[model samples]
Target: MAQFDVSLVLPDTLYHGSTMGAIQGLRIKPINKEFWKDAKDFGAGFYTTIDLFQATTWARKPVVAMERLNKGTDPSAMVRSLPKDQIPVVAVYDCNSNLYTDNIILHDYRGESRAWAQFILSHRHSSTVDNCLCLNEFGWIHPHIACGLMADNDTGQIIEDFRSQGRDIHNRDDLEWFWTQIIRTREGRRLNGLELGDQIAFSAKL
Candidate 1:
């Protein structure tokens, strides 16, 4: 099993001092079901990435969006311009590929299959129950590994644009393109068994 590290930059307000302390204190939790309903590719779980840049981008999103909303500006446009100080904690975790292999049900959506794309598109707007059921199924299968598409900035923008137009576009071409890139660039992996002792290291400004 290959050892890998994943990181997340959360708000500094979430912890007293260090990111490891925050994890130990049970401050890190899976994203809520409501938020998962409209989530882009993968259903909800404790999402992380091997790429620090991607992690930082994901962490800055919510904070920047809120700041723009507070300032009466369009959040989507402002997200890219948001400052890094908005997210002050970077949590890193050490993981073993062995933990993912047999211990977790790995849903690899990294292919050219239209069916896979359709599945993601269908569930992106699915009911909360349905989304939760999908995640619950993962728990029932392996309880530790949750893998799927890691939607990048371009793909996210495309999806958001379509959604804003009240159109649920499931174009296989776009889906295939994005999924291929995401799979190649930042393979999705969520450590479902993440706990305090699991993290290898962390850094926080506060």
Candidate 2:
């Protein structure tokens, strides 16, 4: 199983599929337009960031789906950070900009995923996200499999059911493989070690 340590910037909620024995450290730091950039370091190394904007309207499955469907976009910040030659990242067209989304895996409770999945699936392309989740071969809720979401009981049931039907569910195993690819591929890691002074690093012994 792929081990993970997630740092939560917001309190009062837990992400799905935290590692089987993962240790999550929570820090309550209010983020606004003025504070968003400062929050980047709070999510170093295999972590997720929950912006204050996200916290306001992030709940509800259909809302996420519709947002991706109607206005999904990849932001300049993420695009500028991505190394070339990786699987193409989807960018949604907004009023005057793009938003980059890294969450492609399904939600824990609502089974939601990144916006790209629907786009790829809708376009009839085999979604890399689907393959990654299905082929992981670990328990349904492994962080590698679940990606940015938690692995709650409902999420577990959906995964098992999908597995029984021979469905592709990317789990922890797939995430490990994906990370391996990122680490090994030249283009994928091309940006590695670049002096991004704004990035934050936080870790604690479990």
Candidate 3:
């Protein structure tokens, strides 16, 4: 599996403590200090943000606060319950955001290739990411190249077939151009075999 870094940013000067103070003004029992302490000690927990808000016995208040936040309301009550002035920081390791789809090959290297394809298809993919890191160009491609299982025909065909069927294939142009360039420039490198099969199968199945 590929490893990645995950991070988030919260405005440092936002009204975090302000929201908590608002809650107190309403005579609502103060939320557990542990929650605030946790945010203070470790920014917000990625997994727990929604959970924490949901768990608060006061539902309407949190909802209103969140709505305010959504509407660009300033210093809403919910923000008060959170750590306001300080930016909570958390370091996530081995983060990933891959997703899979129906008809995607899931066996052998094919599964991995499909996953990688899905990732690059995302609008946020890093174009600068390449095989090697530096001078000698050794290990230029990520050692964990999930190029998908060895395919036989042009890889671009699968994307083309997907588009023909009216499915909004992700990264269609980028991947097509990338492979086109690779095939054009490389002396003998070819697209993966299963990818070609995928195209053929998709065409027949469709």
Candidate 4:
């Protein structure tokens, strides 16, 4: 369990898991309209992790999501819904530590701080297609890299909890506060080996 810190030099290798098959190269894309629609810890970008197991876990997310939705969800149904010829993949990349020099812009959120929680809320509130913060000048110059904890789905029920209480998931400030209030609780789960892992997201092509 190596701790991933974007503020420090990245490891020489990183793993990206997705339903998409082998890719020719990495590309920067907007935050996807994923099945969960839960806010990404870091905004739209190329997300890779220090943990191979974590990547493998994400590679099977579509199937996992389906399995969680119902006791006996159809694997074929999930397969048919995805793009043709799609299969779960864990792509490995060779990283250049030298690339993270002073010239590069990075927003590294360390630990579970209130500011980190605030940043997540800010981007989540602006993630709608029409209001993508990444596309606007008002946004924080869109860091070349954004890094933070990758588990907003541990119980797989936080979103539902918000809904059950009529909480506004999109309210930036409110969501930030709510997350901090519960960050300690999630930390305990990690101690018990139910961690969701860490991710370093790149907005720059490098």
In candidate 4, what are the lDDT values of residues 19-98, reduced to their tens digit? 56444333343233332233555665668889999898888877777677866767777766777436677888788867
Model number with the top lDDT? 4
C-alpha local distance difference test of each model:
0.40, 0.26, 0.30, 0.61
Candidate 3 has a TM-score of 0.18
Tens digits of per-residue lDDT, candidate 3, 1-206, equal 66545332221211111233344422342223223322110111111111222223222444454665578656444445555432122211221223312333111223324433433233112222222221232123222112222232333454445556555534566555434432321345554443222211010111
Ranking by TM-score: 4, 1, 2, 3
Worst 10 residues of 2 by lDDT: 197-206
Q: Residue 180 error for model 1, in Å? A: 12
Cα RMSD of all models vs. native, in order, equals 11.6, 18.1, 20.5, 6.7
Can you give the lDDT of residue 84 in candidate 4? 48
What lDDT does model 2 reach?
A: 0.26
Clashes (N, CA, C under 3 Å) per candidate: 0, 30, 15, 0
Ranking of predictions according to lDDT: 4, 1, 3, 2
Candidates 3 and 4 compared by lDDT, better number: 4
lDDT of 2 at 120: 17
